[model samples]
Target chain A: MLIPMAKLQIAGRREELSAVLEGIYRLQGMQLVDVARDPALDVDAAGLNDANSLTQARLELLVARLDALLALVGSDDRGDSRLHGDPDPVSGAVDLADVEAELDRISILVQEAAQHLDSLTDELAVLPRYLHPLEQLARLVPELAALPEYELQKLGLDTAALVLNTSDDTLVDTLRRELTEVFGVRFDLTSARVGTDAIGCLLVFSHSDSARLHALLGQEHVRHLPLPSAYSGQSLFGALAGMRTRLDALPRELADAHQVLEELIGPHVEAWHVTLAGARAELEQLAAAAGAGVTDRAFAVVGWVPRPHVARFHEALAALSMGPLAIEELPHDERAHSTPVLMKERRVARPFGLLTRFLDNPRAASLDPTGLMALFLPLMFGVMVGDVVYGTALLLVGLWARRKFGRISPGIADLCSVLVFGAIWAIIFGFLFGEALGNLGKNLFGDFSLWFYRGDANALQPLLLFALAIGAAHVLLGVVLGMWQSWRDRAHRHLLDRVGTFAFLCGMLGLAGFAAGALPPGFMSPAIALTVVGLVLVMSLHGTLGLIMAPLELLGAIGNILSYLRLAAVGLASVYLAIVANELATVGPLWLGIIVATFFHVLNLALAGFSPMIQALRLHYVEFFSKFFIGGGQAFIPFGKSHS
Target chain B: MDIGIGLIAIGAALAVGISALATGLAQARIGAAAMGAIAEKPELAGRAILLVAIPETLVILGFAVAAMAILLLPA
Candidate 1:
C-alpha cells in the first residue's frame, strides 16, 4: 500500500543548521525536497564555501577509490562478521586525511598481491594444456632415438613430435586418413590424449614423404603445437623432463602467492569496509546541506516524511535541541507535484511489489497493484503451464534457488518467490485440467480427467469461452477499480468513461448468452438497449471526436478480452509438446525412447516455465494495466540513504 | 476430401506462421530501438520489454484463428 506522507518544513538558526540536518539524517525517514526552489525564500541555495567544496571533492574521490578497491576484492559486510559482540572500532565519522593516507598505503599492497594471485592462477590453468600432450611425446620420442638395432634414421625414417590442440575426434580421424594418403601404410602415427582438449601425436614417416606430410598438416590447418622447448636444443625426451620439473614447481608458486595475499589483506579488509561505509555516510550528510535554503541568520529545509515516521522525526529533533527550532507539518498542497511515494507492503505482497516497481512506481494517490498482481499473476501463469511434473520440478528448483541466493540479492529472492507461488498454482491447475506430464497419467492410470483434458480438440470451444470469461472478469474488475479511482479523484470524465466500458461489456456478454439460448428472448432488447446507451455515453463524453473515438475504445476493450485466448493457446501448446514427447518415446528402443522422451519433456518443461510466464506478464502489462495503471511517481530517497 | 483436408492444414499453418512472422518483424524493430534506448538509459529496460511484448498479441490472435480452423472446422 502507498503510505500517507506529511510535508515537513524545518526552519532553524544558521549555527544549528548542521546539527538539525544531521538529526534528520539519523531519522532516516524524510526525502528532502530543496527549499531553495521556493523563490520566496531569500537565501543561498548551495551555501558552499571553499572549505565545503574541498571537503566534497575529497570525500567523493576517497569514496570512489574505496568502492573500486572493495569491489575488486568482492567484499560484502565483512566487518559485521568480525564484530561479534564487540564494539565497532571504526564507528562515528572518520577523519578524511587519515583515511586517505591509510587507503593509499593498503592500495599498493592489495594491487601487488592481487596481481601475483592472478598470474599464478593463469599459469596453473594453462600448465595442464601443455602437460597432457607432452607426456604422450615422452613415451614415443626416446624409443625411436635409442633403438640402436633398428637404425631408423639411417634407413631415411625419422620421428618428429607435434601436439594437436583439438577435441574433435572426426578432425583427428581425417588427419589420420590424409597422412595415410601421403605416406602410405609405411608411416606410423601414434596419438594420445594429452590434456582435456589437446592431443599428443608422434609421427614416424620416411624422409622421402616428409614434405608431403608437412603439406598435409598445413592444408588441414591442424593447429598443432611444435615440440616444447623447456630447455632449447634439448631432445624431445629432455624437453618433457624440464616440463615435468616445472609442473611440479608451479603448485608451490601458486600457494606462495595465495599466502602472500592472505597475509596482506586478512587483517585489513573488514576495517577498510567499515571506514569506507562511514566515510560515505558522512559525505551524504554533508552534501544534503545543498538542499537547504540558508539566509543570514536562519535556514530552511522542506521534505516529505511518511506519516508513521512523524513521531520519530519529532523525537530525533528533541534530542538535538540547541536553539529554538521549528518543524511544522505543512498542509498537503494538492497542486504541488513534489510528493514522493513510499509504499509499505506486506511480506506476502513484497515480491509483487518488486514486479510492480519494475514497470514504474504507482502514483501515491493511486492504488498499489501489488495485492491484485499477487492474486492474479501466478494464477494466470499456472493456467498456462498446468502440469503436475513441471509444477513439482519448478517448485523444487525455485525453493533451491531462493535458499541459495536469497541473502545475496533480494531481487533474485523475490523472483524465486514468484516462481514458487506460480508453481503451486500450476499444481492446482494441473489437477483441475486432469493432466500429469501431458497424457502420461491417463496412460498409467487409465483415463485421469477429473475435469476436461486440455489436449483434446473437443475442449476448444469450452476452453475459448472459459478464457474469455476470465478475461471479462479481469477487465471488469479493472473497470470497477478505475471507476473508484476516478470518483475518489473527482475525475467525472474518467468516471463516465469507465462506466461506459462496464456497461458495454455487460451488454456484450448478455448478447452472447442470449445468442447461445442461455437467456430468455426478452433479454435481447435490454442487452441491445444497454449497449446503445453505453455507446451514446462514451461518444457524448468526447463530443465531436466521439464518433471515431467511441468505436476505437469499444474495439480496444474487446481486443483485450480476446487477448486472454493466449491462456488456452499456451496451455494447449504445452500439452501437445508433451504429447509429442510421449509419442516419440514409443518409437525407439527402450533406452533411446527414454532418452528422447526425457529430452522432449525437458524442452517442453523449459518452454513451459519461461514462455507461459512471459505471456501471463504480457496479459498484465498490456491488457490489464492499460485499463487503469498510470505509473510515474518518484520513489522516496531519504537524505543520507546509500543508493549503492 | 483429402484435398480439402490438405487445404485446411495449409490454412491453419498460414494462420499461425504468417502472424508469427509479423510478430517477429515487429519485435525485431521494437527490440532494436529498445536496446538503443536501454544503452542510453538502463532504467528503461522494463518498459522496453513491455513494448517488445505488445506486438506478440498478433501471434496470439493468429493462434486463436488457427485453433478454430483446425478444431471447429473439422467438426
Candidate 2:
C-alpha cells in the first residue's frame, strides 16, 4: 500500500529552530520540502542566511577531510564487523572548533607518517642500486685489498672491475692484452676464476689512462662494477663490509616504518568513522536550515510526513519546548506539484517493489500496482517456462545465489526472489503440462497430459486459448483499476472512458467467438447491441471522431489480448527444443548420449530462463501498465538520512 | 493432390523462420542502444532488458503461426 502523506508546517522561535530540526532529523520520518516554494508562506529569502550557514560550511569541510582520511586508511563502513552489530544513537551537535582541532591534529600526524613512509620507500628503492654492486664487491674485495695499498695510491691509480660470465673466453684475453700491451696504460689486472664460464678481474689503472682503458674494455660482455661514491677511494674490503651492513639493515628499517604507520592509524579507524557520522548528521541539519526561510523572531519549515507520523512529529517537537508552537497540517490540495511519494509495501511484495521502482515511483495520488505485480509477473513467467526439471534447476540456482550475494546487493536479492517465484509457477505449469525436461516425461509415461496436451504442435490450440483468456482477465483488471481511480478522483468522463473500453472488449470477444463458429448464432444480437452502446458511450466524450476511433480501440484491445499468445508460443518453442535435444542425445552411444543430453538441457534451461523473465516484465510494463499507471513522483527523502 | 503435409511444412517453416528474422532485425538496434544506456547508468539494466525484449514479439507471433499451421493440418 502507498502511504498517504500530510503536509507538515512547523513554526517556532528562531532560536529553537535548530533544536527542532535536530529532533525531526532524529525521528527520521519527515521528508523536508523547500518552504520558499510554498506561496502561502511569506518567506524571506535573505533571512535564510543565519548563523548556521558559516557553521554548515565548516562542517562540510570537516566531512570532506574525514572522507579523505577514511579512503587513505582503505576501509569502508560496510566491510567492518563492528558496524553490523549495533546501531549508533544520534549524537548531539559537535563544536566546530573542537572537531576542526581534532581533524587538524590527526591530519598532521597522518601526513608526517606518510612522509616518513615515502622517504623509507625512496631509500629502499635506492638500496637495490648499492646492494647489487656491494654483493659483487664483497665477492672480490679480498683479492683487491691484498694488493700493496701504498703502491696502489702512489701510482695515482683508479680501479674498475669486470665480471665476465658470458661464453666468450677470447674476450677475457683481449681485455688483458688491450690494457697492458696495445694501450700501454699503467694498469694492473688481477684476475680471479669465480666459477665455470665466469671470471672476475680487478683493474687498477693510472688516473691519466683510466678513461681510455675503461672505454677499451667497455665491450666484450665486461660489466663495469662501480662502487658507491662514499666507498670509491676506501679500502675495497672495508667499504664492501660497511655497505653490506647498511644493505642488511635497510629492509629491517623499512619494515619498522610500515609497522609504525599501521599501528598509528589502524586503531583509530573506528573512532574516526563514528566521529565523522555524528558530524555529518549535524552538517545535514544545517543544510536543511539553509534551504528554509526565517524571520527575525520565528522560523517556518514545510515538509511531508506520512499521516501515521504526524503524532510522532508533534510529540518530538513538543518535548523540545513546553512553550506553545505552531504546527499545522496543510490540506492535501495545497501540496506542490512535486510532492514526494512514500509507500508502505507488504514484506512479501517488497522484493517485487524493486521492479516497480525500476520504472518510476507511482504518482502520490495514483494507485499502487506492486501487490498486483507480485501476483501476475511470476504467473506469466511460469506459464512461459512451464517445465519441471528446468524449474527445479532455476530454483536451486536462485536459492544458492540468494545465500551467496543477497547481502552484497539488494538488486541481486530482488532478482533471486523473482526467480524463485517464477520457478514455482514453472513447476506448477510443468506438472500440468506433464513436461519434466521437454518430452522426457512423455517418453517415460506414454505421453498423457495431466490437464491439457502441450507436447505436440497439434496440441498448441489449448495453450493459445488459455493465454488469450489470461490476457483478457489481466486487461480487464487494469481497466477496472483505471475506472476505480477515475471514480476516486470524481472524473466521470474518465470513468466512462474505461467502462466503454471494458464493454467494447466483451462485445468484441463475443463477436469473434461467433465468427469463429464457437458461439451460438443468437449471441450476435447482444454482441452488436453491446458494441453499439460502447461506441455511443465513448463517442459522447470524444466527439464525432470517437465514433470511428472507438471501434479501432476495440480492435487494439483484441490485438493486446492476442499478444499474450507469445507466452504459449515461447513455451512451445522451449518444449520443442528440449524434445529435439533429447532426440539428438540418443544419436550417440549411452555415455555420449548422457553427456550430450545434459549439455543440451543446460543450454535450453539458460535460454528459456532469461527470456521468460524479460517477456513477463514487458507484459506488465507495456500491456498492463499502459492502462492505469502514471508514474514520475519523486521518492521521499528524510532529513539527515544517508542512502547506503 | 496428396501434398498437403509438405505445403504445411513449408508454411510452418516460413512462419517461424521469417518471424525470427524480423525479430532479430528489430532487436539489433534496440539491443545496441540499451547496452549504451546501461554503460552510462547501470541501474537502467533492468529497464534496458525489457526494452530489448519488446521486439521478441515477432518471434512469438511466428511461433504461433507455425503452431497454427501444424495443428490445422488435415489428418
Candidate 3:
C-alpha cells in the first residue's frame, strides 16, 4: 500500500518558481519532501517564495491565537509554539515618544481603578460586624458615662441589660449613671454568675427604659463584640472571611464589566488580522511588479504536492504562465508494506468520505496490518486466552466500552472485534476438548468424551497434531497473500520470489506428512522435486547464492512451522490458569469461598483478556510481518489549517 | 496434583517476570531517547512515540511466551 516514489530536481526562474510553489501549496492533498537547500542559493530570498514557510508561519500564528483563547477560557495548556510570527511592522517602527505617552496614560488609569476597588473591598469586610445589635449596645457606653447620680431600682433581666467584663468597670459604671438619668429609671449593676464564667456587671433596667437603652446602643461609633455567632476571636480573621466571600461573588457581579472590556479589546485583536491581510496584499503587489522578469532572479523556489493534486497544480501553473517548472513524484517507502493496506484501501474507497480524509493524508505512517492480520491475530489470541467463560466476559466488556465511548481508534476496535471472534472459537474448542476449568474430560460434558481425548495423558498427541496443522495453514496463507500482492503489482521478480516461497512451504508440508505417516513412503520424491524448483526460482529472483542454499531455506521454513505450536501451547496454559482459579476459589470455608471465587474469577478474566490481546498482536506484527513487509512510509501531509 | 500445579505456576511466573523486566528496561532506554528528541522538536512527538513503542514488542513477545507456558501446563 505504500506508494512508490522517485526523487526529482526542479529548476526554474525565481518568479516562475514562486508561482509553481504556490500552485503546489494550493494542492488539496500532498506531502512535501524536505530537500536540503543548496549552499550556493540565498536561503533567505528563496524562503520568501517558499510557500511551505508562509504556510508554517500562518499556522503558528493561528495556533498562538487559539492557545491564547484557550488560556483565557482557563483550559489546560498544550505547550508553546516554536515558530515565531513576524512583528507588526507599523507598531514595531512607531516612535518611542508616542508609545511611552500612551503607556503612561493606560498605567495611571489602571493603578487608580485598582486602588479604589481594593479600598471598597476592605470596607465591605467590616460592614457585617458594624450592623450587629451587640455593636449597637457598645456605642451607648460612652453616652451613659456622661450622666451622673444614678440609683438602683430594677432587678429583672431582659434585652436592656448590657453586660461587660469587670476589667472595664469604670466605663460600665459611668454608662449606667448616664442611662439612669436619661430614662428616669435607676440602672443597677448586678454581679451574677452565668455558666462557669464570672459576669462582672449586668445593667438591669425597667421595661420602659429598655427601649431608650436599645435606641442609644443602635447609634453608630461603637466598637463592640459582634453577634456571638459572628465573633471569630480576632477582628482580622472575621474581616478576612467576609472579604473572601464577597470576592468570590465579585466575578458574577462584574460579568457585564468584563464583557465591555472584551468588546474594547476585541478591535485590537482584529487588528492583527488586518495587518496580516495587508502584508499578503503587499507581497502580491511586489510579485505582480516583478512580472516575467521575476523568473530571471538568482534564487530557486521548491515545494511538494500530493499525487492526486498534481493535475490541479499543473492547471494552476498553466493559468499563471509559470511553465518550465519541474515536478517530481514522491515514492512511498515503508518498513512494513502490509501495515498500510487497510488505510490505503480505505483511502481509495473513500467509504467514510471527508471523515477519513485525515487518514488518507496523515502526517504519520498509517501502518496498521488488517487483512491477514485479521485471521491469525484472533486465532492466536483465542489460543492464548483458552477459557470460554473468560473470553466471553472480555468480549462483553469490550462491546460495552466501544458503545459507551463512541469514538475509538480502528486498531483497538479491530482488536476487540478479533477478541470476540476468538472467544467464539475458544468456546467450541474448549468444550470439544473437555478443558473446562482445566479439569480435562473428567467432570465436564460427562458422557460426551468422544469429541476429545480425556485428560492430559490422552490429549497430548492429538493436540500436537492440531498445532502442527494450524501452523502449516497459517504459514501457507502468508506465502499465498505475498504472492497475490506481488502478482497484482506486476513485479515479476517479487512474484517469482513469492512462488518460490509457496513451493518451499508445500514441499516441507509434504515431507512432514510423510514422516508422520500421513503420506506414502514415496512422498519425499515430490517434496524434493518441488523444493528444487522453489530453490531455482528463489535464486533467479534473488541471487545465485540463494539458489545454492535453497535446501537450507526449506529447513528454515520447517523451523518457522514449529513456531505455530506455541499457539496450542498457550491455549493449554490458559486452561490451566482457569483450573487454578477454580481450585483456589473452592479451598476456603463456604462464605470465604464465595468471596474468593468472585475475586479469582475477576482476576483470571483480566489476565486472560490482556495476555491474548498482546500476544495476538505480536504474532502478526513480528512473525507474519517479517516474511514480506516493509513499513517506513512517510505519511502524506497537506498544506492547510491545522487544529491544535 | 498440587506439586505439578505448583511447579507449572512457578515456571510460568518466572518466565513472565523475566520477560516483563527485559521489556521494561528496553522500553525505558528507548523511550528516554525518543523523549529527548521530542523535547528538541515537539512536532516529532507522534513519530517519536511510535518509534519508542517498537521496542515494547519484546515485552509482548515475552507475554506470549508466558501464555504458551501456562497453556502447556499439565492439567
Candidate 4:
C-alpha cells in the first residue's frame, strides 16, 4: 500500500531557520519541495539557492575533498560499516580545518608511498626477464663470474651486460672484435649464446672509455639490453648484485609498503565515510534552505510528510523555540510536481517491495502493486517448477543465504527472502503435481501423486488449459485493479475502457467454452450478447480510433492469455529432461548411470532455477503489468538521506 | 506412417521450428540492444529481461499450435 502524504509548510523567523532545518534533518521525515514552484504556497516565494552562497560552496568543496580522500583510502578492512558513527551535520562546522589538515597529511604520505610501491611492483615483474638471459649467459660462460668481484666504480671499471639480436653465430665475436678496435684491449668481453637468436655478453671496460664502448654497441643487430629504471646507470655486476639483493627483499618491502598504507588508512576509513556523509547531508540541508521561501521577516520550508507520522513529525521538531513558529498542512497542487510516494507494507511483504521499486516507485496517490507481486510471482514460479527434490534444495540454499549474507547486502537478502517463499510454493505444488525428480515419484511409489503426474502426455491439454486459466484470472485481476485506480483518479474514460475490456474478456471466454462444447448451446446467445455489448461500450468510448484499435486489442488480449502456455511448455521440458536423466541411469551400469543421472539432474535443476523464474516474471511484467501498471514515479527521498 | 500423417507431422514440425527461428532472431536483436542499454543504465535490467522475454511468446505459441496438431488433428 502507498502511504498518504501531507504537503506541509514549516515557517519561522530567519534566525531560527538553521535550528529548525536541523530539527527537520534529524527527524528524516520530510521530502523538501521547492517553494518557488509550489503553487500551493500562499505567500510570494523567494529562492534561497543564492542565500549564503559562500557557506554552501565551502561545504560542497569539503565534500569533494573528503570524497577524494576516501577514494584514496580503500574500503574498510573489516567489511562492516557498523564500526563507524553516523554523521552529525548539525553538531558544528569547527571540524572543517581538521578535515583539511587530515586530507593534506594523507595526500603527501600516500602520494610518495603509492609511487614507490607502483614502481617496485612493475620492476619486480620486469626484473625476471633480465635474470633469465643473464643466468643463461652466466651458465654458458664461466669467466663472467670474475666481473662481480670488482666494486667496479671504485676500481674505475664499468660493465655493460648486452643481449644482441642476431642470426649470425659470429655476432658476439664481431661485437668483441668491434669493441677491441674501438678501445684497443682497454676492454675485456665474455660472450655466450643467450637463446637461439641472441647473444648475452658482459663487457668490462674502463669507466672513462664508456662513451666510445656504447657507440659501437649501438650499431645495427647489437644494442645494450635495457635495464629496469631503478638499476639504470650502474655497472652490470653491481646492478646484478643489487637486483639479487632487491629481489630477495622486494616481497618483504612490498608487504611493508602495503602494511604501511593499511595502518595509515584502515582505521579512519569508516570515520572518513561518516564525515563525508555528514558533510553531504549538511550541504543538502543548505541547498534545501536555499530552495525554501522567504519574506522580509519569515522563512518557510515546504515539504511532504507522511500522514500517519504528521504528529510525530511535528513532535520531532518541537525542541526548536523559533519565535511565532507555525507548521500547517497545505493542499496538494495536482499539476505542480514534488509529491513523492512512500510504500507502507507488512514485514513479510517488505522484501517484495524491492521488486516493485526496481521498475519504479508507485506514483503518489496510485496503487502499490507490491502485495499483488508478492502473492503472484512466487506462486507462478512454484507452478512452473513443481518438484519436491529441487524445491527442498532451493529452500535450504535460500534460507542459508538469507541468514548468512543478508546482513552484508540488503538486495541479496531481499532476493533470498523471495526465493524462500518461491521454494515453499514449489514444495506445495510439487506434492500437488506429483513430481519428485520427475517420474521418480511414480517409480518409487506407484502413482504417489496427491493430484496427477505432470509428466504424462495425457496431461498436456489440461496443463495448457490450467496455465491459460491462471493467465486469464491474473489479467482480470489487473484490469479490476486498473479500473479501481482510474475510478479513484477520476479518469472516466480509462475506467470505462477497463470495464469494457473486463466484460469482453469474460464474455469471450464464455463463447470459447460454448464453441468447445464445454457450455450448452443455450448459453451462446447470452455470451454473444455480452461480447457485443462490451465491444459497443469500448467502441463508443474511442469514437473513430476505437473501431480498428479495439478489435486489434481483442486479438492482443487473447494473445496475452495464450502467452501463458509457456508455463506448461517449460514445465514439461523440465519434467521430460528429468525423466530422460532417470531412464539413462537405469539403462547403463549402476555406477556410471548414477553419475550420469546426477549430472543431468543437477543440470536440470540449474536450468529450472533461471528458466521458470524468468518465465513467471515475464507473465507478470508483460501480460499482467500492461493491464494496470503506470511506472516512472519518483521515489520518496527524505532530506537527511545520503545524497550519494 | 501414411503420407497424410507424414505431411501433417511436417506441418507440425514447421509450425514449431519456424516460430522458434523467428523468436531466436527477435530475441537476438532484443538481447543485444538490451545489454547495451543495461550497460549504460543498470536500473533498466528488469525491463531489459522483460523485452528479451517478450519475443519468446512467438515460439511458445508455435509450441501450442504443434501440440494441438499432434493431439487433436488425427483424433
Candidate 5:
C-alpha cells in the first residue's frame, strides 16, 4: 500500500542538526524528505569532520589494497573464478596494514636491482674499445700476405691509420676511390664529430670478417676517441624487453614476500582485530552519547520498523528520553495502484496476503459474487476454444507450470488458473455438443448419435441465448457488488441507486422472455411495467431528467448483454479449429496426416490458450472491475537498507 | 465441387490476411508507444511487452478459425 507522507521542516544548530539527522538515520524505516538547512546558522560538527577524514583515509587504503589484489590475480581467464567468489572478509581487513609495509620493502628492492642492471648494461656498451688492437692485427695479417713489398710499403704507410678528422668532402671521396682501385679493400669509415668542424673515419679492408672488425674497433685509439656505445639505443631497448619477464614476475614475488610477512606477523592481525573491535565499541558509545537527549523541535524522527519491531523500537527511543515516535504501519499491496488491505492485527495470517486482504475488506464483497462469474468465465473460455483434447492439454501444462515455477505474478498465475478451469469446462461442453476437434454435429457414439446433421448448422440462437443469460447474471453481480461497497461506505442513496438498476435489468429480462414466449404473458407483462416504473422512480430520486432517459438506459443495458456473445463465439471458434485439425489428420497420407495433425493441433492449442486468457482478463478489468474499483493508491516508500 | 472447395480456401485466406493485418497495425501503434515508454524507463519492459501482446491474441484466434475452415472443408 502506498503510504501518505508529510514533509518535515527542521531548524537547529548545525551540530545539533546533524545529530538529529543521525538519530533519524538510526530510526529503522522512516523516509526523510527535503532535509535542508540555513548555512549561516548551522555550525559544522567537530565529530562529523573527524568521521569524514577517517572514512576518506579508510577508502584510500581499501582502493590501494584492491589494486594490489587485482595485479596478483592477473589479466587472464584464470582470474575469472576470483571475480565470482566472495572474498574472505576477515583476510581482507587483516591484509590492509601488511600491504603498506610490504609495498615499501618491495619498492626499495626493485629500485636497487634496476639501478644495478642499468650500470651493467652501460659497462657492456663500452667493452668493444679495449679489444681493438688485436682486431687490427687480424685484419693486417690477412691483407699484407696478398700484397707485394712495394705495395705493402705503400699500404704500410696508409696502414699507420691517421685519425685526422675530415669534414672536407672532396678529400674523403678521393681517398675512397683510390683505396677501392689500388688495394681492392674497402675504406670502412668510422666517423665521430669530436667538436665543431671535426670528422674522422678508420679505413679497413671491406673483405675483413666481423671477428677482425670487432678486434680492430676495440683498439685503444677507438676506445679513447669515444666510439658509439654498442648498447646505445638498440641494446637499451633489448634490456627493457628482457626486464618485462622480471617486471611481470613482480606481483608473484611480492605475493611470496607478503606471505612470509603475514606468517611472521600473524599474531599482530589478531591484535589489530581487537583494536578495531575496541574502536567500534568507542564509536558506538559516542553515537549513543550524541543521541542521549531530544530537543523540543516541531518535527520528530519517523521510520519504519517491521511490525514486530515497533514495540521494541518505541521502548528503546523512550528509554533515551526521546518520548514516543509516531509509528504508521504500511500494508504490502503488490498491485501497482490497488487499495491496501490494512490489517488491524500484527500477525499476517494468510499465505496470499493480497487475497486475504480482499477477504477482509467488506467493500470488496463483489469478489465472491455468487459463483456465476466463476462458472461463466471458464465456460465461455472453453466454448470459445472448443476442443476437449486441446483444453485438457492446456490444463495439464498450466498445472505443471504453476507447480514448477511456484509463485510468479498473481495476475498471470490467476489468469492461468482461469484458463485451466476453462479447459475443464470445454471438455464437458465438447462432449455435450458431440464436437471433438471441430466436428459440430459429429457423433462419437455412432449408433447412439442423437443429432443427424453432419456439418455447419446455425447454433447462433442457442449460443446467443446462453450469452444473454450469462450476461444478465454478470451485470446483476456487478450491481450487487456496487451496492455492497456503497453500503460499506454508508452511502445510502448509492445503495438505492444500485438496487433500482438491478431490479430494472431483471424486469427488462423478464419482458424479453415473455415477448419471446419463453415466459407466461401475465407474469412478464407486469414485470415489464414494474421494471419501467422502478427505473423511473430511481432516476427521479436523483433528478427529474433521469425519468426521461430511462428508455435510453434500457437500450444501453441491452447492448451490454450482447457483448457477452463474444464468449460463445470464441468458444465455438475453438471447437471448430479442433475439428478441422482432426479432419486434416484423418484424410491426409500417413506421413502427411501425422505432420498436418501435429502442426494444426499445436497451432489451434496456442491460439485457443492465449485468446481466452486475454479476453477473460478484459471482461474482468473492464466489465467487472469498472463497477466498483477506483484504484489510485500510492505505493509505500520506506527508508531501509536496499538488498539490491 | 472443386469450385466450392476453392471458394472456401479463398475465404479462409482472406480471413487470415485481414486478421493478421489488423493485428499488425494495432501492434505497431501500441508497440511504438510501449517502446517510447521503455526508452524513458527501461524497468517497464516486462509489463509493456505483456500489454502490447494483449490485442495480438485476436489475430491468433482469427488464424485458428481460418485453419479450421481450411481443414474441415472437403478437399
Candidate 6:
C-alpha cells in the first residue's frame, strides 16, 4: 500500500535549530524538502548565505574520508547487506575525535607498510634477472672475481654485458667482427651458459670506442644486459650472495608487516564502523539543514513526513526545548505534484516491494501493485513450469539458499521466498499435468493412481483455452484497477471509458465464441447488442475518434489474451524435451543411458525453469502494468541516514 | 506413416523452425541492448529481463501452431 505523507514546516530559533534537527534525525522518518524554492515563501528570505553554513564539498570530503577509513579497516558497508544488525542509537551523542586520531595513525602506518612491501616485492621480482646470468658466469669461470679494468684495456675495452639464446652465439661473433670493421674498435667477449637455452655474454671495448661499439651491436641485433643498481661495485659472487639474502628475507618481512598492520587495526574494525556511521549521520543532517530557508534568528525547514508518524515527530521536536517553535502540517493537497512516495507493506510483501522498486516508485496518488504482482507472478510461473520432480528440486534449492544466505542479505532471502512460492505452484501444476521429469514417473509406476493425464499433444486445446481464460481475467482486473484509479481522482469520464472498454472486450470474446459455433444462438443477439452499447458509451467519451480507436483497443486486448498461449506452449516444450531425454537414454547401454538422460534433463530443467520465470514477469510488466501504473514518483528518502 | 501424416509432420517442423529463427534474431538485438542498459544502471536488470523475454512470444506462438498441425495427424 502507498503510505500518505503530510507536508511539514518546522521553525525554531537559530541557536536551537541544530538541536531540533538532531531530534528529527533521531526520528529518521521525514524527507526534507528545500523550502527556499517554495513559491509560498518570500523571495527576500534572510540568512540564505550565512557564514556559519557548512559547504557541500566539505560535507562530502568528510563522508568520503570516513568511507576510506572504514574500507581501510575492512568494515566498509558500501554494497554489502547484512541481514542482522543492532538498531541505530540516537543521533550525535558520541564524540569521534579519539577514534579519528587512531584512524589517522593507523592509516599512515598501513600506507608505510604497504609501500615497504611493494618495494620489497619489486626487488624480489627482478632478482632472478641478475641471479640467473651471474650464477652461470660464476660457474663457467671459477676465479673471474670481477671484470678487471687492466685485462679489459688489453683489447682497448670497457665492460658491457649481453644476454642471448644459444643460437645467438653466432650473432656475438658477427657483432665482434662487425664492430672491429664498422667502429674500428677491438673487442674481447666472454660467453657463459645462463639458463638452459640462454647465454650471457660480457664484452670489453675501448672507452673511446664505446658509443661506436653500441651502434654496431644494435645493427647486429645484439641485446644489452645492464646490471641492477644493487649489483654495482661488488664482485659477481658478493652481489649474488647479497641478492640471495635479500630475496630470502623479503617474504618474511612482507608477512611480518601484514601481521603487524592486521594486529594494530583488526580489533578496532567494528568500533571504527560505528564511529564513522555516527559522524556521517551528523554531517548528513547538517547538509540537509543547509538547504532550508532562514530568517534573521530562525530557520524554516519544509519536508514530508508520513501521516501516522506526524504526532510522534511533534513529540520529538517538543523534547528539544527550542523556544516558541512552530511545527505545522501543510495539507497534502498543497504539494500534490511534489509529494514523495513511501510504500508501507507487511513483512511478507517486502520482497515484492523490492521488486516494484526496479521500475519507478508509484506516484503518491497511484495504487501500489507489489501485492498484486507477488500473488500472480509465481502462479503463472508454476503453470508454465509444471513438473513435480523439477518443482521439488527448485523448492529445495530455494530453501537451501534462504537458509545459507539470508543472514547476508534480506533482498536475497526475499527473492528465495518468491522462488519457493513459484515452486509450490509448480508442484500443483505438476500434479495436474501428471509429469515428473518427462514421464519418468509414469514409465516407472505403470499407471499410478496419483497420475493425471500427461500434458501431451492431446491436451493442447484445453490448455490453450485455459491460458486465454487466465489472460481475460488478468486483463479484466487491470480494467478494474484503472477504474479504481479514475474513481480516486474523481475523473468520471475516465471511469466511463474504462468500464466501456471492459464491456467491449467481453462482447468481442462472446462474439468470437458464438461465430465459432461454440456458444448457443441466444448469445449472438446480446453479444451484438452489448458491443453497440459499449461502442456508444466509449464514443460518448472520446467523441468520433473513439469509433476508429475502439476496434484497435479490442484487437490489442485480443492480442494480449493470445499472448498467454506461451504458458501452454512453453510447458509443452518442457514435456517434449523431457520425453526426448528419456528416449535418448533408452537408446544406449544402461549406464550410458542414465548419463545421457541426466545431462538432457538438467538442460531441460534449466531452460524450463528460467524461461517461465522471465515470461511470467514480462506478462505482468507489459500486458498488466500498462493498465494503471503511471510511475514517476520520487522515492521517500529520509535525512540523517548514510544509506536508504 | 501415411502421406497425410508425413505432410502434417513437415508443416509442424516448418512452423516451429521458422518461428524459432525469428525469435532468435529478435532476441539477439534486444539482449545486447538490455546488457548495455544493465551495465549502466544495475537496478535496470529486472526491467531489462522483462524486455528481453518479450520476443520469446514469437517462438511460443509458433509452438502453438506446430501443436495444432501435429493434432491433424491420426492417432
The prediction achieving the highest TM-score against the true structure is 4
Q: Write the per-residue lDDT of candidate 1 for residues A1-644, one digit (tens) a residue.
A: 88878888888888887777767776677888776676544557765678888988897898788776665545555444543342232258778889889878988987888788787677667767666666667576566646552365456775556667777656667777877776679788777776688776777777787677777778777654664444444444445556678779988987887777667666776677677767776677677687687778888888888888898877877876667888888777532345688878888888888888888888777878888889999999998888888899989989999999998889999999999999999998888888888998878876666678887768888788888888999888888888988887788999999999888888988998999888999999989988888888999999999999998998788888889999988998899999999999999899998999999999998998799888887788888887888688888888766423
Error of 4 at A350 (Å): 2.2
The lDDT per prediction is: 0.80, 0.77, 0.51, 0.80, 0.51, 0.75
What's model 1's overall lDDT?
0.80
Candidate No. with top lDDT: 4
Q: Evaluate model 3 with DockQ and give the value.
A: 0.13
Q: Write the per-residue lDDT of candidate 4 for residues A211-233, one digit (tens) a residue.
A: 87777667544677877777788
lDDT of 3 by residue, A11-32 (tens): 5665455445444443433333
Q: In model 4, how large is the Cα lDDT of residue A599? A: 98
**After superposition, candidate 5 runs with Cα above 4 Å error:** A1-379, A403-422, A428-436, A440-459, A490-500, A534-556, A636-644, B1-75
Q: For model 2, what is the alpha-carbon lDDT of residue A164?
A: 78
* Model 1 Cα shift for residue A342 (angstroms): 1.8
Error in Å for residue A509 of model 2: 1.2
Looking at model 4, the pairs that clash are A48-A290, A49-A290
The candidate that wins on DockQ is 4
The runs of at least 3 residues in candidate 1 whose Cα sits more than 4 Å from the true structure, single-residue gaps closed, are A38-46, A68-90, A101-267, A316-324, A334-337, B2-6
Model 2 C-alpha lDDT per residue in residues A475-579, reported as the tens digit of each score: 889889989888877889989998988888888789978998999999999998877777778877788888788667766666667678878877877888899
**Error at A529, model 5, angstroms:** 3.2
Tens-place lDDT per residue, model 6, A514-597, is: 987899999988888877777788877877787787667766766777788887777777888898999999897999999999
Query: What TM-score does prediction 1 earn?
Result: 0.77
For lDDT, candidate 1 versus 5, the one ahead is 1
Deviation from native of the Cα of residue A381 in model 1, angstroms: 1.3
**Any runs in candidate 4 off by more than 4 Å, and if so which?**
A37-51, A70-89, A98-111, A118-226, A233-248, A262-277, A319-323, A333-337, A536-547, B1-7, B73-75
DockQ of 5: 0.15
Q: Give the per-residue lDDT of model 5 (tens digit) for A1-644.
A: 21222322333343354344444444534333221221212222223347645644654554454343333323221334323332222221234456457646654654454455444444444343423432343343454435554564454322323334556656556655654554455444434433355444445443334345446446523332332354222221232333444446555655565554334334333333333333332343244323222344433232233344455655654454443344344333233233222222222112222322221331211233214345556766765665556667888987776666546566456545655677787667655555655662354544222332113454545655665687677777777778787786677877777777777888888888888889887887678776976687578666867756755665555555555656765665666666677777779688998899789878878888887766654554445544555343333333322210
